[model samples]
Each structure stands twice: as C-alpha cells, then as structure tokens.
Target: MVRPGQIYKISANILKSRLQMTIRASISCNGVEIADVTQPVKEGVPEILNMRV
Candidate 1:
C-alpha cells in the first residue's frame, strides 16, 4: 500500500517522464517507414505495460 502523498509524487513523476518521452520520438525503419502503425512503442502487442511479464 502506498501513503497519501507518496503515491501522488510517484504518479506525478511517471506523468512527467511520459510527457518528456512524448516530445522526443524517432522512427524505427531506415529506408522505409511502417504504415498504419497503431502504437509507437509496441506495434503487435496491444498492452505495452504487460511487457514486463
């Protein structure tokens, strides 16, 4: 369980990091770019957060 202020701080940090990464993005392909890409990080996998498992 997380304390009141602790969770807020952790969540705030996560949002800040996510926002930073969003500002900086790169293409994976060298010669050609992929078409109809749903998600930037995970293409096939719908749940990118589940990659840890």
Candidate 2:
C-alpha cells in the first residue's frame, strides 16, 4: 500500500530475453502517475530499471 507524504522507490530487473525489445514502465499512486521510463533491452542480457517517487 501507498501512504501520503512518503517517498518510494521502484525497481525491476529483466533477465533471459530471446529477442531485443523495448520495455516501458509506468508508476502510479492514487491514480496519479509519478514516473515513466523507457528502456531498450538486448538478448541474453540483464537490465535494471529504477525509479523514485
């Protein structure tokens, strides 16, 4: 759950991809978007996505 007057960090890791593609992520709190990120991913590689709100 999300509380008011607090800061949060979100993270995600991508692993074991067979094809290269783009990853898009959106973070929202209480129907309001806080962070939006777009990353390009490669095959057989690991990628980390991080955002702060």
Candidate No. with top TM-score: 2
TM-score of each: 0.17, 0.58
lDDT minimum window of 10 residues, candidate 2? 4-13
1-53 per-residue lDDT for model 2 (tens digits): 65555555444455666777888877787799877677887865566765554
Residue 31 in candidate 2, Cα distance off native in Å: 1.9
Model 2: CA > 4 A from native? 1-19
Clashing pairs in 2: none
Report the Cα lDDT for residue 30, model 2: 73
Which residue pairs clash within candidate 1? none
CA lDDT scores, all candidates in order:
0.24, 0.66
Model 1 scores a C-alpha lDDT of: 0.24
Q: What is the C-alpha RMSD of each candidate to the true structure, in Å?
A: 15.9, 3.4
